[model samples]
Target chain A: MNHIFSFFVLGGIIAAAINGKIDVVTTAAMTAAGSAVQRAIALIGIVGLWMGIARVAEKSGLIDKLSHLIAPLFSWLFPSIPKNHPALGCILMNLSANILGFGNAATPFGLKAMQELQKLNNDPDTASEAMCTFLAINTSSVTLIPTTLIALRASAGSKNPSEIVGTVLFATTCSTITAIISDMIIRNLYRRRKYN
Target chain B: MTSEMLGESFSWFIPGLIFIVFLYGHIKGVRIFEVFIEGAQEGFIMAVKLIPYLIGIYISVGIFRESGAVDILVKLLSPILKVIKAPTDALLLSIIRSLSGPAALSMTMEIFDTHGPDSFIGRLASTMLGSSDTTFYIIAVYFGSVGIRKTRYSVLLGLLADFASFVASVYIVRKVFL
Candidate 1:
């Protein structure tokens, strides 16, 4: 994180100097920060809206029912999670929120899932198979709605703001499928190399 | 399904989900209003907490784009990108998409502004942004929070997934939109 941040900042400044865009960079700094705050404010609206609904769904047992609807798939994906484990529930909720594209709502659930998975870690410093698989799938983002993109397109005055939803579904599905397969393959390879 | 049909259904999906949430809450006797307010407040807090992260990324990305460095990298990678049949315009987006959520949004917004949101590049950018999470950031935060150092092949898997997402977005956008 530290290196990437510094690298981007320093590299950009150096490149600006060579490209004689120091003035542009100076202007960008101000405008970028300004836009960042504006974007955050806008985020507050959507995040608040979805998280609110998610909370209601969670409290009303809707989310639980939804999780149960997909529990079989979760179990298959995370066979290592012990039956009735809290981490499994957390993982389910997290992935459900992710698939629904309620990303802000997903983060808390994901963090909770990580902590629960941590308790199951035999090697304190090493990531377990379940942890790796969870993180891999989480990072892959199996979103179905992608509310953010749709909202952005709407604001940008697209003729059909929601049109990307279909493409996003296809794209995210591909990534998630790839992530799961790769996780399975690499972990097996890791186990074989370590044990043999 | 046609894009228009898919879009209409999805557009209804959100409102349908919201209505079902409310109806279910009412049926379950949840303090629907209060719970919603509480969750909404949490959302405000989360958004506030994310501001610093967003500013940090936005500034760096803004400077990087302003400096023309991104364009240079795209140029240098054109041969390989061409060989792979990847859209050169989306190269920086896919790289930054994995690194920073806010940065990727900023890039997508710029693309939309430059190309018009209905254009092929704009639609492609939209799909790309929605296609994958910020893989590097997710790994760093999730594993870092757990204090796990030996992350093994998760990072590789995550990037591979990200690559798959980009390729899928490009292919689907071409097939459906172009």
Candidate 2:
């Protein structure tokens, strides 16, 4: 079913390209791949560094202490996940990676979070509310530095490559806020419908 | 080395410091090799999963470019560009650039070489490419790899964000730098 939708979108794009829109599409694809490769390489290093740090932190008990410190805040944000759940730890690790703009690094943590979420779910077919909420937040993840953007800007020869930092911060914050609010609203509406 | 050269040498110092830190961590019982291999294995698996979507995205991009649809859309949106006080050339260039970075960069470089990098058009193209995302590629690759069947509002939001960045890049570059 979804394959059809994908086919249509692909067909539309191809049709456009054939009709002389190829220049734009071709350029976008090439650039995206180029940027993705460069970003991925940089991300591997960054993630490696962070993961090493995180591992050390865990070994030294800092992660536990830090998790304890941030437990209240995390609990407030994710009331769905029990405080002691392993998913909470995964979520924190994922969030930390995301905050640092290490999406490559965050990917494992995100998967781990999902795995943990799956364990807590009684129904294997339907996604849990926690899963939905996590997906919502992860999809609209807020990034402070936007390292990839900075790298792109620098490569594009921006004199002040980091100037967009403030704007990105504002935009991501708005997106995250919107995601959370919408998730809550939809969940509430669904609950109401089910009850009524 | 000269004093100035010595001062410039410190640029290498930070990376050296990082290497030492990594080594120290490795020696202190961190199984860096095993973890890295594990991560790489996962990444490879993800890359395999993403191939289909990536192909779809590439094909779509190919069709979009060939269909004359973008040109029509560009023409239709020209009036809106004027209202925003952005140069029509820059606006079009940005849209194209966002879709393809290297092509955009090459275009920017061409414009820069011909008109100079200090030109508004060159700066605008560079800025736009820098700030905005390759929306279709992101949707197809990232979301697809994760097996997100329904994108819901993500596609709309991503495109909207791209547009916002496109406009803002022009505004900032023109108003502040240019």
Per-candidate DockQ values are 0.53, 0.17
Which stretches in model 1 have alpha-carbon errors above 4 Å? Answer: A1-71, B1-76
Where does candidate 1 chain A have its weakest 10-residue lDDT segment? A62-71
Q: Model 1, range B1-178, lDDT digits (tens) per residue?
A: 6545655665675567678889989999999999999978876776676677667767877777678877777778778677657677787898778866877898899998999999998998999999888886677556655567677788788889998998898889989987
Per residue, candidate 2 scores C-alpha lDDT tens digits across B1-178 of: 3323433554454455346545655666766566545545654565555555555555545444445555666888999887778876676665565354445556666665665444676556555644454555544544555565555444544445556656666666667664
Kindly report the interface RMSD of candidate 1, rounded to 1 decimal: 5.3
Best of the candidates, lDDT: 1
Give the lDDT of residue A48 in candidate 2: 47
Q: Give lDDT for model 1.
A: 0.80
Q: For candidate 2, write residues A1-196 as lDDT tens digits.
A: 2553454456556655566454555665565455455545554454445444444434434445555767787787777777756677767777766766666667656654665676776665455667666666665555655555555555656566566565555545655566567767777777888799
TM-score of chain A of 1: 0.69
